[model samples]
Target: MNTEQPLKERLKQILNQNGHALSFEEREILLHELIDLHGQAKEGKNNETEQIRQAFLHNLCHVPQSLTHETFSRFFAENIKPADFRALEWEMPEQYFQITEALYLLRSHIETEKVFDYVTELLVHALRSFERNGEYKKMIELLQLVPVPPSAMNQELLSLRAQAHIHETRRVQHFRQLLYKYLFLQALLIFVAFPILFVKAENGAIAKTIEEATDVEMTEERVQYLSYADGLYWSIITAASIGYGDITPVTNIGRIIAAILGSMGVITIGIIAGLILDRITPRNF
Candidate 1:
């Protein structure tokens, strides 16, 4: 609170006055921590807990803005108000916040961390939702709204935070697009692949292969998106061509679809393997 000393001067003093070896990542991490704490302060209520949270928030907020690039929770930190925390229900976990008490050390944490935890939970939920259904449009909007640290602060550092942020942002964008494709492909399995796989049944019932393979449910409203596990399962089932005896397409059209998935599934796995080989091989990632 020294008026004569500007915020930057104070921070420079804190950072440089005690000459410590700090890497660019470390520097950016510290800045992110500071911003997160400050965001904590801005949302404090009038209660005693709020007072403490605000105090910490203020201390961190007063630090000189980073001259180097670092991304932190710019969205919430910049726009946060004291009363925003009160509307926690909107971000609350499925109307059953109490269930998560066991997961997060709610009782021991500073009130600010509790809020941070809340934000983290919401984030995971949103990401998982997007991952499941390839709900591309909504997912992208939420991605933009994520509370990443700003990349503009801290000009003097081993590595510019901006570059790191860009890398991360690009990575996320790529996955989002890729996941979207996979989701579409999952649904497309029925519409595109099945029509080609159906074989005529002697009982006048079109048997996929003289086998009692389950019919895959091809509902327009119901979209089945695979997860990391599901994708793995898909690979296993598709690679081995051993239907799980569950979740199959039954109609002649469905059979055709399965046939397509079965064949594509083999090459798909190979393509993934090639990519993995390429990455460790060099630039695969």
Candidate 2:
């Protein structure tokens, strides 16, 4: 049985509901209606295009799926006139325009088995739109959809793919750098807190124990006990939640500060791990 015939009939029912020829605007509207209907019936609503160009793609998707690959190849190859496209370019929304241009490329590729100048132009435009919109993932997917044309166009495709990759890498690095900055700030907080707590602490057993362990002198007066370098080293150990027991605080305020630093260390570690996993994870194209 011909699946396309039934699908075309469904589309015609939608298009002919008003009993009019397909106007440019009505074509767009009816296409959206079809997409919504199709989503309800067949595919899920997980696609970004479902969010961005819900009406056009849904209807366009049906057109391609209705026919066999060969039929689709031939249909576009024979029917899309350059003059018609030139005219459509002036009127169609950019989302529609990009899809149409991609169709044209597919059609041309089917006929000649090589890349055309038009395909190059279409890719460049698509890349710019995707990059501007922060759609690096979409760009990666689109690049894959783009059939490798001739040897000349292969390089262009590779270059665009590389550009998308570079953008993604930079984004991951930025996130990692941000995580590192937070960790540094938290460590600095611990560094500053250690000395202050040491000075404020009474000359109790805990103070004397820390002094002996760290090989430093803790005075009852509000004076520095540990050097700045030692303070920072101790801060790192505390932030790591290691609790080496060599420089523990006996005062209530010191214990409270230690608790806060431990919590912060856990959160910072979690964020850094998540970011690293995101960078390493394979993205679905």
Candidate 3:
């Protein structure tokens, strides 16, 4: 009887079978058996070891089964090479893609942060691959699959996210609408600040610092308290981050308010500038 041939054939058949119906324990058992077989084969023949590895990966890719965290931890420990980490920086190998896809499918079943970090790193590389191919929508879709930790996000991921948003906005023809929203927010901040400043000025919180420059003597009736128009103008200038120094805040509360407004204005301007650059930049790059 050709027992070895039959065993090899049966293993191949199991590899071809979909393991989605199998429980985690069942999958773990099968995985352990395969690893043992591969390890035994590795002792005498390199070709058999390679063949078994390829079959194992092929089976892993096709099966949507979830394995236990310990199984995955062991699997990665045995399989992951230094080359696998290097591949993330350059062209991603097809094997890596398959592995990442398989892990992504079982993301919800993952319990350990270590296993999840592996999945996240792989997916980030996959996202970069999509970005290189100008597949922004696909990149965005893949990103939405996992809840990537904020700590793992580098500048590369942030750039990918921005590109995805720009591509989506361009596709949906909502660029103008987005611009309008930003402008509305800016205007809203200005108007909201206006009311607060007007109230402060009404309480004698604001004063004109250049009273002598205007050759006006300070008096009870002739005191140049900031007017409503001046307060609104100050709010506009403060939000624009263009402090002209024509008016000044006398109270500590008023200075604090101005400082906050100035910081917000700078951030808003930066956002607007980034939006404009994104709109004007060519997509071909």
Candidate 4:
């Protein structure tokens, strides 16, 4: 029975059932409806759209289920892209715009195969967009309708490119934030804390430790000792076993710090090493 069916006949039936097709009149109706929905969502009335979207999503989540939102699975490949749910971009709430953009980029990628290159493009696009002091808020509108020629293959490719770019940029930003936090914490260890913590140095450290003529110089110095950064770095270096010889603690209490940091270094290294074994490990990129 399936083999006897025409491809367009089967697809048309499926799309119609999934609410994908739009006659010119239907497109007009959707345009106005989307504008209204956008306004309502902005006014915090997305309960209706949320309900509609969720119902379709949940139904497809069943074991014997759909291949798209209401039809095929999201990952299904086809010649032309399925019309995006957020086809009416301007009609969406501002907060929903980014997510809508993300989905569009994703769907576009499904239609096109240039996933990695598209993502790199988005990163650069975001950077240049920011540098130009370009209009950030309305830029999303420009994004959705990036003028694919009427050809099905070209449309599919551009959509995919746009989607890949968005996904990569978002992932990169999230990763960048983690790195920034790591660096900030690292800087705190290097510049702010190591200078103050000291224990009477023995061996090569003794001459330099004695020469400082200072340790815990003021009230700020006293407060810094209580901070976690003090122990964290000591632990990091000790754990890495890099005893860099430069940043070790000097004062009596500082030497006491070395003991704690040294022990911490051991535990931290084990944790970092174990993290590498997981399946969805944090991307270093």
Candidate 5:
């Protein structure tokens, strides 16, 4: 019996039957009217009125087959005001996503160059959101979606894309450099410590070639000097996984150190290889 019920049903029927017949301007006007009606009906929790508003909004957002670039530009200018695209305090509004989606749909229907400024502005706005949230990866992915802009157009898009890649590459490179330094320092420390450990081993840590060659053990001084030299050489070769067999570890402690050095060598080499590949490989995006 309610008048609002009949009005809501009538609006829904009009949208369902004659929606495509209406021009964008007329549809936009209807959408605004439905929004007001929906607000009033919200107090009464009228689901039917909400459905009608949504239907009208859906129709408004879509581009018609007969739509022309000029009419689209005019309608876009009038209905999609610049003020509506302004950044919100917390999150972007639903309208922002809707407008972007509409713009994407309009790409086939209209010359994007005509709306280049608006498209760029929207992209910048979206990027600012990601930047504020520290979502660099998402920013890169979003930039990838856009085709490379022609040089004749504003260079802002190209600049933004380049800057994002540069920033990401620098960040990755900094981390890799830090990791490389840490590994190098660790290897250096182990190299320095090897002689000390070898000198203290109860049994000679390395093969006693000088003692064995003469069939008379070398003097303590000679043994000590050779121990230091052998320790330095062995550490380098073992850590590099290039055991030349000219120097070798004989004791348990020496073998344990060899294992550790070998593992570290593999890891270090992997990191270096990754760095080289990253430098040489062309990034797809």
Candidate 6:
């Protein structure tokens, strides 16, 4: 409840403007009660502003009950931490959602006072926390619900929105770059290294003999020692770090090449995993 007489008068005027018609006696009774409660509000109570807002909310049919200043003070003392704004328990999703909606409501209607400015600051804090959590899209979505403030605050919100977009874009680009690198390496193994290895193996002689007998190519024909499709499959599976061992190199040189490829695969996969974690993890608030 607001103790200031002028603010009480302003509230009366605002109520009348919103189509509430209170008799003179009724208005006097309500204003005096609020003033008395405001007088009783203790020192060091953190939720006096919230109590006043709740009074307005009750009259506006937004809340089930209007909280007294003392009740609000006690509630917050028990439930809220003075440090970071996290609730002790996040199990009640609907309660959190309702609080967000209530804040939006307050932002839209409340006059630009200290209380309203504090609400705006809380919204900004929430935005920063969401950004740190890597919930960029969610942060943007929540920001959209906030009514535009004065030019300066609105610009600040817009800047935060832009920052979220830039980070998301960078994340996407990093993923695409990693993907391209992996695919290029896979292609090199399939198209260049695999063909050379296949042609040098003893299997190449047998395959060449079969090709000549079948007249698939002339005696001068270049033999394809391994199936190109099989080589591609092996490249994909090996890079994925899932060697099923169905098809393997038979020669010593081929085994050495496989060892090198397996090592490269391990290092590349580790790098990719680290990049993904970096993208998802939240930065400092």
RMSD values for the candidates in order, in angstroms, are 20.8, 12.8, 15.6, 16.4, 11.9, 15.8
Residues 36-60 of candidate 1 have per-residue lDDT tens digits of: 4434433333443343333322322
User: Candidate 2: TM-score?
Assistant: 0.45
What lDDT does candidate 5 reach at residue 58? 53
Residue 184 displacement in candidate 6 (angstroms): 1.0
lDDT for every model?
0.41, 0.53, 0.59, 0.40, 0.57, 0.51
Model 6 collision count: 0
Alpha-carbon shift of residue 91 in model 1 (angstroms): 47
**Could you tell me which residue pairs clash in candidate 5?**
none
Each model's backbone clash number: 29, 1, 0, 19, 0, 0
Model 4: lowest-lDDT 10 consecutive positions:
79-88
* Clash tally for model 1: 29
Better of 3 and 5 by lDDT: 3
Q: TM-score for each prediction? A: 0.23, 0.45, 0.39, 0.29, 0.50, 0.37
Q: State residue 87's C-alpha deviation in candidate 6, in Å.
A: 12
Q: Least lDDT summed over 10 consecutive residues: which range in candidate 6?
A: 86-95
Cα lDDT of model 5 by residue, 1-285, tens digit: 577776667666665654357766666566555555554564566555545434543554443321234544344444343333333221333434455666655666456774565666767666666667776666666666655457533565566667778877876777667767876797765578765565444145344554577677644432223466677777677667746887655565556766777787778788778866774343555
User: Best candidate, TM-score-wise?
Assistant: 5
Stronger candidate by TM-score (2 vs 5): 5
Model 6 ranges off by over 4 Å: 1-98, 102-121, 131-153, 201-285
lDDT at position 61, candidate 5? 43
Model 2: weakest 10-residue lDDT segment is: 84-93
What's the TM for model 1?
0.23
Model 6: pairs clashing at backbone N, Cα or C within 3 Å: none
Q: Model 5 residue 217 lDDT?
A: 64
